[model samples]
Target: MSISPIAEPFYADARPIGPDGRRIGVLLSHGFTGCPASMVPWGRHLAGLGYAVAVPRLPGHGTSWQELNKCRWADWYGEIQRAFDKLTANCDQVVVGGLSMGGGLALRLAADRGRDVAGIVLVNPAVHTERKDVLALPVLQHVIPSLPGIANDIKKPGVEEHGYDRTPLKAARSMLAGWKQVRADLPKVTSPLLMFRSAEDHVVDPSSGQIILTSVSSRDLTERILEDSFHVATLDNDAPMIFEESAEFVRRVTGP
Candidate 1:
Protein backbone atom coordinates (compact mmCIF):
# COMPACT_ATOMS: atom_id res chain seq x y z
CA MET A 1 0.00 0.00 0.00
CA SER A 2 1.06 3.59 -0.55
CA ILE A 3 2.53 5.41 2.44
CA SER A 4 0.29 8.40 1.77
CA PRO A 5 -3.23 8.70 0.47
CA ILE A 6 -3.99 10.15 -2.94
CA ALA A 7 -3.73 13.94 -3.14
CA GLU A 8 -6.99 15.85 -2.94
CA PRO A 9 -7.41 18.78 -5.31
CA PHE A 10 -8.74 22.25 -4.54
CA TYR A 11 -11.83 23.34 -6.47
CA ALA A 12 -11.33 27.13 -6.63
CA ASP A 13 -9.24 30.25 -5.98
CA ALA A 14 -9.68 33.84 -4.76
CA ARG A 15 -11.14 36.25 -7.29
CA PRO A 16 -11.17 40.02 -6.89
CA ILE A 17 -14.07 42.22 -7.97
CA GLY A 18 -14.68 45.94 -8.29
CA PRO A 19 -13.64 47.75 -5.10
CA ASP A 20 -16.78 49.94 -4.97
CA GLY A 21 -19.06 46.89 -4.82
CA ARG A 22 -17.04 44.66 -2.48
CA ARG A 23 -18.19 43.40 0.88
CA ILE A 24 -15.81 42.92 3.78
CA GLY A 25 -13.61 39.89 3.03
CA VAL A 26 -12.64 36.97 5.27
CA LEU A 27 -9.55 34.78 5.07
CA LEU A 28 -10.46 31.24 6.15
CA SER A 29 -7.73 28.73 7.01
CA HIS A 30 -8.18 25.01 7.56
CA GLY A 31 -6.66 22.83 10.27
CA PHE A 32 -3.36 20.99 10.05
CA THR A 33 -3.41 18.29 7.40
CA GLY A 34 -6.79 19.57 6.23
CA CYS A 35 -7.56 21.09 2.86
CA PRO A 36 -9.73 24.02 1.82
CA ALA A 37 -12.34 21.39 0.96
CA SER A 38 -13.21 21.17 4.65
CA MET A 39 -13.90 24.90 4.94
CA VAL A 40 -15.74 25.31 1.61
CA PRO A 41 -19.21 25.33 3.11
CA TRP A 42 -18.30 28.01 5.62
CA GLY A 43 -16.73 30.12 2.87
CA ARG A 44 -19.75 29.65 0.62
CA HIS A 45 -22.10 30.77 3.37
CA LEU A 46 -20.09 33.95 3.95
CA ALA A 47 -19.97 34.61 0.22
CA GLY A 48 -23.77 34.24 0.12
CA LEU A 49 -23.95 37.15 2.56
CA GLY A 50 -22.13 39.32 -0.05
CA TYR A 51 -18.74 39.03 1.71
CA ALA A 52 -15.71 38.02 -0.28
CA VAL A 53 -13.96 34.97 1.25
CA ALA A 54 -10.58 33.41 0.62
CA VAL A 55 -9.62 29.88 1.72
CA PRO A 56 -6.01 29.15 0.86
CA ARG A 57 -4.48 25.67 1.07
CA LEU A 58 -1.51 25.67 3.39
CA PRO A 59 1.93 24.54 2.30
CA GLY A 60 2.30 20.75 2.23
CA HIS A 61 -1.45 20.19 2.62
CA GLY A 62 -4.04 18.66 0.26
CA THR A 63 -1.03 17.11 -1.38
CA SER A 64 0.93 14.35 0.33
CA TRP A 65 2.08 13.36 3.83
CA GLN A 66 5.73 13.86 2.94
CA GLU A 67 4.99 17.42 1.90
CA LEU A 68 3.02 18.01 5.10
CA ASN A 69 5.84 16.79 7.32
CA LYS A 70 8.19 19.30 5.70
CA CYS A 71 5.91 22.23 6.54
CA ARG A 72 6.34 24.33 9.68
CA TRP A 73 4.00 26.73 11.44
CA ALA A 74 5.60 29.77 9.82
CA ASP A 75 4.79 28.39 6.38
CA TRP A 76 1.16 28.07 7.38
CA TYR A 77 1.07 31.51 8.97
CA GLY A 78 2.70 33.09 5.94
CA GLU A 79 -0.01 31.63 3.76
CA ILE A 80 -2.69 33.21 5.95
CA GLN A 81 -0.89 36.56 5.99
CA ARG A 82 -0.64 36.60 2.23
CA ALA A 83 -4.31 35.82 1.86
CA PHE A 84 -5.27 38.36 4.53
CA ASP A 85 -3.34 41.09 2.75
CA LYS A 86 -4.98 40.19 -0.54
CA LEU A 87 -8.45 40.32 0.99
CA THR A 88 -7.79 43.68 2.60
CA ALA A 89 -6.65 45.11 -0.72
CA ASN A 90 -9.96 44.18 -2.32
CA CYS A 91 -12.42 45.01 0.50
CA ASP A 92 -12.92 47.76 3.07
CA GLN A 93 -12.12 45.48 6.04
CA VAL A 94 -11.07 41.90 6.75
CA VAL A 95 -11.74 39.17 9.31
CA VAL A 96 -9.56 36.12 9.90
CA GLY A 97 -10.82 32.67 10.91
CA GLY A 98 -9.63 29.09 10.99
CA LEU A 99 -10.25 25.58 12.32
CA SER A 100 -7.86 23.73 14.69
CA MET A 101 -4.22 24.64 13.91
CA GLY A 102 -5.52 27.19 11.50
CA GLY A 103 -7.20 28.91 14.45
CA GLY A 104 -3.89 29.33 16.23
CA LEU A 105 -2.43 31.02 13.15
CA ALA A 106 -5.49 33.23 12.86
CA LEU A 107 -5.04 34.36 16.45
CA ARG A 108 -1.38 35.05 15.84
CA LEU A 109 -2.19 37.21 12.83
CA ALA A 110 -4.92 39.08 14.65
CA ALA A 111 -2.66 39.62 17.62
CA ASP A 112 0.20 40.88 15.52
CA ARG A 113 -1.89 42.99 13.20
CA GLY A 114 -3.98 44.47 16.01
CA ARG A 115 -6.42 47.07 14.64
CA ASP A 116 -5.72 45.96 11.09
CA VAL A 117 -7.60 42.74 11.63
CA ALA A 118 -11.28 43.57 12.12
CA GLY A 119 -12.16 40.33 13.96
CA ILE A 120 -11.40 36.64 14.41
CA VAL A 121 -13.27 33.30 14.56
CA LEU A 122 -11.70 30.19 16.02
CA VAL A 123 -13.35 26.74 15.74
CA ASN A 124 -12.02 24.10 18.13
CA PRO A 125 -8.70 25.95 18.16
CA ALA A 126 -5.68 24.18 19.61
CA VAL A 127 -4.37 26.70 22.11
CA HIS A 128 -2.54 24.76 24.81
CA THR A 129 -2.49 21.10 25.88
CA GLU A 130 -0.98 18.67 28.40
CA ARG A 131 -2.00 15.66 26.35
CA LYS A 132 0.75 13.06 26.16
CA ASP A 133 0.07 12.44 22.49
CA VAL A 134 0.95 16.02 21.65
CA LEU A 135 3.99 15.90 23.92
CA ALA A 136 5.27 12.64 22.47
CA LEU A 137 6.30 14.29 19.23
CA PRO A 138 10.02 14.28 19.90
CA VAL A 139 10.30 10.57 20.68
CA LEU A 140 7.90 9.53 17.93
CA GLN A 141 9.84 11.52 15.35
CA HIS A 142 12.75 9.09 15.63
CA VAL A 143 10.91 5.88 16.50
CA ILE A 144 7.60 5.91 14.72
CA PRO A 145 7.36 5.69 10.95
CA SER A 146 4.81 6.72 8.41
CA LEU A 147 1.58 4.74 8.01
CA PRO A 148 -1.03 4.70 5.28
CA GLY A 149 -3.93 7.01 6.09
CA ILE A 150 -6.42 9.57 4.90
CA ALA A 151 -5.51 13.27 5.13
CA ASN A 152 -8.76 14.50 6.66
CA ASP A 153 -10.89 13.41 9.62
CA ILE A 154 -14.43 12.18 9.02
CA LYS A 155 -17.16 12.94 11.52
CA LYS A 156 -20.89 12.75 11.05
CA PRO A 157 -23.06 15.63 12.28
CA GLY A 158 -23.51 15.59 16.05
CA VAL A 159 -21.02 12.79 16.79
CA GLU A 160 -17.70 12.56 18.62
CA GLU A 161 -14.60 10.54 17.84
CA HIS A 162 -10.83 10.44 18.45
CA GLY A 163 -10.07 11.87 14.99
CA TYR A 164 -7.97 10.53 12.13
CA ASP A 165 -6.92 6.94 11.54
CA ARG A 166 -3.24 7.82 11.91
CA THR A 167 -1.43 10.85 13.27
CA PRO A 168 1.83 11.98 11.69
CA LEU A 169 4.29 12.53 14.52
CA LYS A 170 6.58 14.98 12.75
CA ALA A 171 3.65 17.06 11.65
CA ALA A 172 2.31 17.04 15.20
CA ARG A 173 5.71 18.16 16.46
CA SER A 174 5.76 21.13 14.12
CA MET A 175 2.22 22.11 15.10
CA LEU A 176 2.92 21.91 18.83
CA ALA A 177 5.92 24.14 18.40
CA GLY A 178 3.71 26.62 16.58
CA TRP A 179 1.09 26.54 19.34
CA LYS A 180 3.73 27.25 21.96
CA GLN A 181 4.75 30.33 20.02
CA VAL A 182 1.12 31.41 19.72
CA ARG A 183 0.52 30.92 23.45
CA ALA A 184 3.40 33.21 24.29
CA ASP A 185 2.07 35.88 21.95
CA LEU A 186 -1.65 35.80 22.78
CA PRO A 187 -1.54 38.68 25.25
CA LYS A 188 -0.77 41.06 22.40
CA VAL A 189 -3.90 40.25 20.40
CA THR A 190 -6.67 42.76 20.95
CA SER A 191 -8.98 42.16 18.00
CA PRO A 192 -12.52 41.02 18.81
CA LEU A 193 -12.58 37.23 18.94
CA LEU A 194 -15.32 34.65 18.53
CA MET A 195 -14.37 31.21 19.80
CA PHE A 196 -16.40 27.98 19.42
CA ARG A 197 -15.52 25.00 21.53
CA SER A 198 -16.91 21.48 21.41
CA ALA A 199 -17.94 19.98 24.74
CA GLU A 200 -16.66 16.55 23.69
CA ASP A 201 -13.48 17.21 21.71
CA HIS A 202 -11.30 14.11 22.01
CA VAL A 203 -8.28 15.43 20.16
CA VAL A 204 -7.51 18.42 22.35
CA ASP A 205 -7.51 18.95 26.10
CA PRO A 206 -10.72 20.53 27.37
CA SER A 207 -8.73 23.33 28.95
CA SER A 208 -7.43 24.35 25.53
CA GLY A 209 -10.49 26.51 24.94
CA GLN A 210 -10.20 28.10 28.38
CA ILE A 211 -6.61 29.16 27.72
CA ILE A 212 -7.75 31.28 24.78
CA LEU A 213 -10.62 32.75 26.78
CA THR A 214 -8.24 34.00 29.44
CA SER A 215 -5.22 34.94 27.36
CA VAL A 216 -6.32 37.14 24.49
CA SER A 217 -6.74 40.87 25.12
CA SER A 218 -9.85 41.03 22.94
CA ARG A 219 -12.43 42.48 25.35
CA ASP A 220 -15.19 41.63 22.93
CA LEU A 221 -14.49 37.91 23.00
CA THR A 222 -17.47 35.56 22.77
CA GLU A 223 -17.38 31.87 23.59
CA ARG A 224 -19.91 29.18 22.59
CA ILE A 225 -19.96 25.42 22.95
CA LEU A 226 -21.07 22.95 20.34
CA GLU A 227 -22.31 20.30 22.75
CA ASP A 228 -23.25 17.82 20.03
CA SER A 229 -19.96 17.76 18.15
CA PHE A 230 -16.31 16.74 18.40
CA HIS A 231 -12.96 18.31 17.50
CA VAL A 232 -13.86 18.90 13.87
CA ALA A 233 -17.02 20.68 14.95
CA THR A 234 -17.04 22.68 11.74
CA LEU A 235 -18.23 19.53 9.96
CA ASP A 236 -20.33 18.01 12.71
CA ASN A 237 -23.92 18.71 13.69
CA ASP A 238 -22.88 22.08 15.09
CA ALA A 239 -21.69 23.21 11.67
CA PRO A 240 -24.80 25.31 11.23
CA MET A 241 -24.13 26.84 14.61
CA ILE A 242 -20.60 27.62 13.47
CA PHE A 243 -21.95 29.17 10.29
CA GLU A 244 -24.57 31.26 12.08
CA GLU A 245 -22.28 32.46 14.86
CA SER A 246 -19.44 33.33 12.51
CA ALA A 247 -21.77 35.15 10.16
CA GLU A 248 -23.17 37.13 13.04
CA PHE A 249 -19.68 37.98 14.24
CA VAL A 250 -18.68 39.40 10.86
CA ARG A 251 -21.91 41.35 10.68
CA ARG A 252 -21.48 42.83 14.13
CA VAL A 253 -17.89 43.90 13.52
CA THR A 254 -18.28 45.17 9.95
CA GLY A 255 -21.85 46.41 10.30
CA PRO A 256 -24.27 45.18 7.62
Candidate 2:
Protein backbone atom coordinates (compact mmCIF):
# COMPACT_ATOMS: atom_id res chain seq x y z
CA MET A 1 0.00 0.00 0.00
CA SER A 2 1.21 3.46 -0.73
CA ILE A 3 1.84 5.83 2.15
CA SER A 4 -0.78 8.47 2.69
CA PRO A 5 0.09 11.89 1.40
CA ILE A 6 -0.07 13.21 4.93
CA ALA A 7 2.47 10.60 6.00
CA GLU A 8 4.97 11.57 3.35
CA PRO A 9 8.07 13.62 4.04
CA PHE A 10 6.56 17.09 4.22
CA TYR A 11 9.03 18.95 6.40
CA ALA A 12 11.67 21.38 5.15
CA ASP A 13 15.09 21.27 6.80
CA ALA A 14 16.77 24.58 7.69
CA ARG A 15 18.43 26.12 4.66
CA PRO A 16 21.62 28.05 5.37
CA ILE A 17 21.97 31.59 4.11
CA GLY A 18 25.06 31.92 1.89
CA PRO A 19 24.79 34.60 -0.76
CA ASP A 20 22.41 36.99 0.98
CA GLY A 21 24.39 36.99 4.27
CA ARG A 22 21.16 38.08 5.93
CA ARG A 23 21.65 35.63 8.82
CA ILE A 24 17.98 36.10 9.66
CA GLY A 25 15.93 33.12 10.80
CA VAL A 26 12.25 32.45 10.11
CA LEU A 27 10.01 29.78 11.61
CA LEU A 28 6.78 29.00 9.77
CA SER A 29 4.08 26.61 11.07
CA HIS A 30 1.21 24.90 9.28
CA GLY A 31 -2.43 24.98 10.37
CA PHE A 32 -4.51 22.41 12.25
CA THR A 33 -4.81 19.12 10.38
CA GLY A 34 -2.40 20.64 7.87
CA CYS A 35 0.94 19.12 6.94
CA PRO A 36 4.11 21.07 6.14
CA ALA A 37 3.19 20.88 2.48
CA SER A 38 0.97 23.90 3.06
CA MET A 39 3.91 25.95 4.31
CA VAL A 40 6.63 24.37 2.12
CA PRO A 41 6.19 26.79 -0.75
CA TRP A 42 6.45 29.77 1.57
CA GLY A 43 9.47 28.39 3.41
CA ARG A 44 11.23 27.42 0.20
CA HIS A 45 10.64 30.89 -1.16
CA LEU A 46 12.34 32.41 1.88
CA ALA A 47 15.17 29.91 1.74
CA GLY A 48 15.64 30.59 -1.94
CA LEU A 49 15.93 34.27 -1.02
CA GLY A 50 18.88 33.39 1.29
CA TYR A 51 17.14 33.41 4.67
CA ALA A 52 17.50 30.47 7.04
CA VAL A 53 13.97 29.07 7.23
CA ALA A 54 12.50 26.06 8.99
CA VAL A 55 8.96 24.80 8.46
CA PRO A 56 8.50 22.23 11.18
CA ARG A 57 5.68 19.71 10.91
CA LEU A 58 3.74 19.63 14.16
CA PRO A 59 3.70 16.48 16.27
CA GLY A 60 0.81 14.10 15.54
CA HIS A 61 0.53 15.79 12.14
CA GLY A 62 1.57 14.46 8.71
CA THR A 63 0.67 11.01 9.97
CA SER A 64 -2.97 10.45 10.71
CA TRP A 65 -5.82 12.53 12.05
CA GLN A 66 -6.51 9.81 14.61
CA GLU A 67 -2.97 10.23 15.89
CA LEU A 68 -3.52 13.96 16.07
CA ASN A 69 -6.36 13.31 18.49
CA LYS A 70 -3.89 11.59 20.76
CA CYS A 71 -1.73 14.71 20.94
CA ARG A 72 -2.46 17.87 22.91
CA TRP A 73 -1.73 21.54 22.52
CA ALA A 74 1.48 21.20 24.48
CA ASP A 75 2.86 18.66 22.04
CA TRP A 76 2.19 20.89 19.09
CA TYR A 77 3.49 23.99 20.86
CA GLY A 78 6.65 22.23 21.98
CA GLU A 79 7.49 21.21 18.44
CA ILE A 80 7.35 24.79 17.17
CA GLN A 81 9.14 26.07 20.25
CA ARG A 82 12.04 23.75 19.51
CA ALA A 83 12.14 25.01 15.93
CA PHE A 84 12.19 28.63 17.11
CA ASP A 85 14.96 27.91 19.57
CA LYS A 86 17.09 26.37 16.86
CA LEU A 87 16.58 29.43 14.66
CA THR A 88 17.39 32.02 17.33
CA ALA A 89 20.43 30.12 18.58
CA ASN A 90 22.40 30.80 15.42
CA CYS A 91 20.75 33.66 13.55
CA ASP A 92 21.09 37.33 14.50
CA GLN A 93 17.28 37.70 14.54
CA VAL A 94 14.21 35.47 14.25
CA VAL A 95 10.62 35.84 13.06
CA VAL A 96 7.68 33.48 13.54
CA GLY A 97 4.65 32.95 11.36
CA GLY A 98 1.77 30.54 10.68
CA LEU A 99 -1.63 29.99 9.12
CA SER A 100 -5.03 29.48 10.84
CA MET A 101 -4.56 27.41 14.04
CA GLY A 102 -0.83 27.52 13.48
CA GLY A 103 -1.14 31.28 13.70
CA GLY A 104 -2.49 30.98 17.20
CA LEU A 105 0.42 28.75 18.11
CA ALA A 106 2.89 31.28 16.68
CA LEU A 107 1.29 34.05 18.72
CA ARG A 108 1.60 31.97 21.85
CA LEU A 109 5.29 31.48 21.06
CA ALA A 110 5.73 35.24 20.74
CA ALA A 111 4.12 35.73 24.13
CA ASP A 112 6.36 33.20 25.86
CA ARG A 113 9.54 34.22 24.02
CA GLY A 114 8.98 37.97 24.68
CA ARG A 115 11.54 40.27 23.07
CA ASP A 116 13.35 37.29 21.62
CA VAL A 117 10.89 37.26 18.74
CA ALA A 118 11.68 40.08 16.30
CA GLY A 119 8.42 39.81 14.37
CA ILE A 120 5.36 37.67 13.53
CA VAL A 121 3.34 37.03 10.37
CA LEU A 122 -0.14 35.50 10.29
CA VAL A 123 -2.28 34.50 7.36
CA ASN A 124 -5.95 34.33 8.42
CA PRO A 125 -5.21 33.49 12.03
CA ALA A 126 -8.18 31.81 13.76
CA VAL A 127 -9.00 32.25 17.45
CA HIS A 128 -12.72 31.98 18.28
CA THR A 129 -15.64 30.56 16.41
CA GLU A 130 -19.28 31.65 16.57
CA ARG A 131 -20.49 28.09 16.00
CA LYS A 132 -22.53 26.82 18.91
CA ASP A 133 -21.33 23.28 18.24
CA VAL A 134 -18.00 24.38 19.63
CA LEU A 135 -19.59 24.55 23.05
CA ALA A 136 -20.58 20.92 22.66
CA LEU A 137 -17.05 19.81 21.78
CA PRO A 138 -16.30 18.84 25.37
CA VAL A 139 -19.12 16.32 25.25
CA LEU A 140 -18.77 15.44 21.59
CA GLN A 141 -15.11 14.74 21.94
CA HIS A 142 -16.06 11.75 24.04
CA VAL A 143 -18.77 10.82 21.59
CA ILE A 144 -16.91 11.36 18.36
CA PRO A 145 -13.24 11.18 17.47
CA SER A 146 -13.36 13.52 14.50
CA LEU A 147 -15.41 15.79 12.32
CA PRO A 148 -15.53 16.70 8.66
CA GLY A 149 -12.20 17.95 7.45
CA ILE A 150 -11.55 21.67 7.11
CA ALA A 151 -8.30 21.41 5.26
CA ASN A 152 -7.40 22.65 1.80
CA ASP A 153 -9.51 25.78 1.77
CA ILE A 154 -7.68 27.06 -1.25
CA LYS A 155 -9.33 29.26 -3.84
CA LYS A 156 -7.23 28.17 -6.75
CA PRO A 157 -8.47 25.34 -8.96
CA GLY A 158 -7.34 21.70 -8.61
CA VAL A 159 -5.00 22.55 -5.75
CA GLU A 160 -4.85 20.15 -2.81
CA GLU A 161 -3.19 20.86 0.57
CA HIS A 162 -2.66 17.13 1.46
CA GLY A 163 -3.67 17.60 5.09
CA TYR A 164 -5.70 15.22 7.20
CA ASP A 165 -9.09 14.86 5.57
CA ARG A 166 -10.76 14.48 8.97
CA THR A 167 -10.58 17.15 11.67
CA PRO A 168 -9.77 15.59 15.02
CA LEU A 169 -12.22 16.63 17.73
CA LYS A 170 -9.98 15.85 20.70
CA ALA A 171 -7.11 17.80 19.20
CA ALA A 172 -9.42 20.66 18.34
CA ARG A 173 -10.59 20.94 21.94
CA SER A 174 -6.98 21.19 23.04
CA MET A 175 -6.31 23.79 20.39
CA LEU A 176 -9.32 25.83 21.53
CA ALA A 177 -7.93 25.95 25.03
CA GLY A 178 -4.66 27.12 23.51
CA TRP A 179 -6.37 29.90 21.59
CA LYS A 180 -7.98 31.10 24.82
CA GLN A 181 -4.55 31.41 26.39
CA VAL A 182 -3.14 33.16 23.35
CA ARG A 183 -5.99 35.69 23.34
CA ALA A 184 -5.43 36.43 26.99
CA ASP A 185 -1.76 37.08 26.36
CA LEU A 186 -2.21 38.96 23.09
CA PRO A 187 -0.90 42.12 24.71
CA LYS A 188 2.49 40.44 25.18
CA VAL A 189 3.02 40.23 21.41
CA THR A 190 5.21 43.29 20.94
CA SER A 191 6.89 42.06 17.77
CA PRO A 192 6.27 43.69 14.44
CA LEU A 193 3.29 41.93 12.77
CA LEU A 194 2.52 41.39 9.13
CA MET A 195 -1.00 39.94 8.83
CA PHE A 196 -2.80 39.03 5.63
CA ARG A 197 -6.56 38.54 5.59
CA SER A 198 -8.27 36.85 2.69
CA ALA A 199 -11.27 38.80 1.50
CA GLU A 200 -13.06 35.47 0.89
CA ASP A 201 -11.60 32.90 3.21
CA HIS A 202 -13.60 29.70 3.49
CA VAL A 203 -11.97 28.14 6.52
CA VAL A 204 -11.48 31.01 8.99
CA ASP A 205 -14.09 33.69 9.56
CA PRO A 206 -13.22 37.31 8.76
CA SER A 207 -13.95 38.30 12.36
CA SER A 208 -10.96 36.21 13.47
CA GLY A 209 -8.59 38.65 11.77
CA GLN A 210 -10.23 41.60 13.49
CA ILE A 211 -9.94 39.87 16.84
CA ILE A 212 -6.17 39.58 16.34
CA LEU A 213 -5.72 43.25 15.42
CA THR A 214 -7.89 44.41 18.29
CA SER A 215 -6.04 42.18 20.73
CA VAL A 216 -2.37 42.50 19.77
CA SER A 217 -0.26 45.34 21.22
CA SER A 218 2.10 45.54 18.27
CA ARG A 219 2.10 49.11 16.97
CA ASP A 220 4.40 48.07 14.12
CA LEU A 221 1.67 46.01 12.51
CA THR A 222 0.84 45.73 8.83
CA GLU A 223 -2.38 44.23 7.46
CA ARG A 224 -3.21 43.37 3.88
CA ILE A 225 -6.55 42.11 2.60
CA LEU A 226 -5.93 39.32 0.11
CA GLU A 227 -8.65 40.00 -2.42
CA ASP A 228 -7.67 37.22 -4.77
CA SER A 229 -7.26 34.21 -2.48
CA PHE A 230 -8.88 32.15 0.26
CA HIS A 231 -7.82 30.96 3.73
CA VAL A 232 -4.86 29.00 2.33
CA ALA A 233 -3.48 32.15 0.80
CA THR A 234 0.01 30.74 0.89
CA LEU A 235 -1.07 28.33 -1.83
CA ASP A 236 -3.72 30.40 -3.48
CA ASN A 237 -3.62 33.13 -6.05
CA ASP A 238 -1.62 35.52 -3.87
CA ALA A 239 0.91 32.90 -2.73
CA PRO A 240 3.84 34.56 -4.46
CA MET A 241 2.86 37.86 -2.91
CA ILE A 242 2.89 36.31 0.57
CA PHE A 243 6.26 34.66 0.00
CA GLU A 244 7.93 37.84 -1.32
CA GLU A 245 6.34 40.16 1.22
CA SER A 246 7.21 37.92 4.18
CA ALA A 247 10.82 37.68 3.02
CA GLU A 248 10.84 41.46 2.77
CA PHE A 249 9.27 41.74 6.22
CA VAL A 250 12.01 39.61 7.79
CA ARG A 251 14.73 41.54 6.00
CA ARG A 252 13.34 44.90 7.03
CA VAL A 253 12.80 43.88 10.65
CA THR A 254 16.19 42.21 11.07
CA GLY A 255 18.10 44.88 9.07
CA PRO A 256 20.44 43.84 6.25
Model 2: per-residue Cα lDDT at residue 26: 85
The candidate that achieves the highest lDDT relative to the unseen native structure: 2
Segments in model 2 whose C-alpha atoms lie over 4 Å from true places: 1-22
Evaluate model 1: give its lDDT: 0.76
Residue 4 of model 2 has an lDDT of 57
RMSD of each: 4.0, 2.4
Q: Count the backbone clashes (under 3 Å) in each candidate.
A: 2, 0
Reference-based TM-score of each model: 0.86, 0.93
Worst 10 residues of 2 by lDDT: 6-15
Please provide, for model 1 over 145-242, each residue's C-alpha lDDT reduced to its tens digit, 9 standing for 90 to 100: 44444333435733322223455668778788888888888999999899998887766666778888888888998999888777777777788989
lDDT of 2 by residue, 141-248 (tens): 999899999988888999999888899999999999988898899988889999998999778887678888988899899999899998889889999889888888
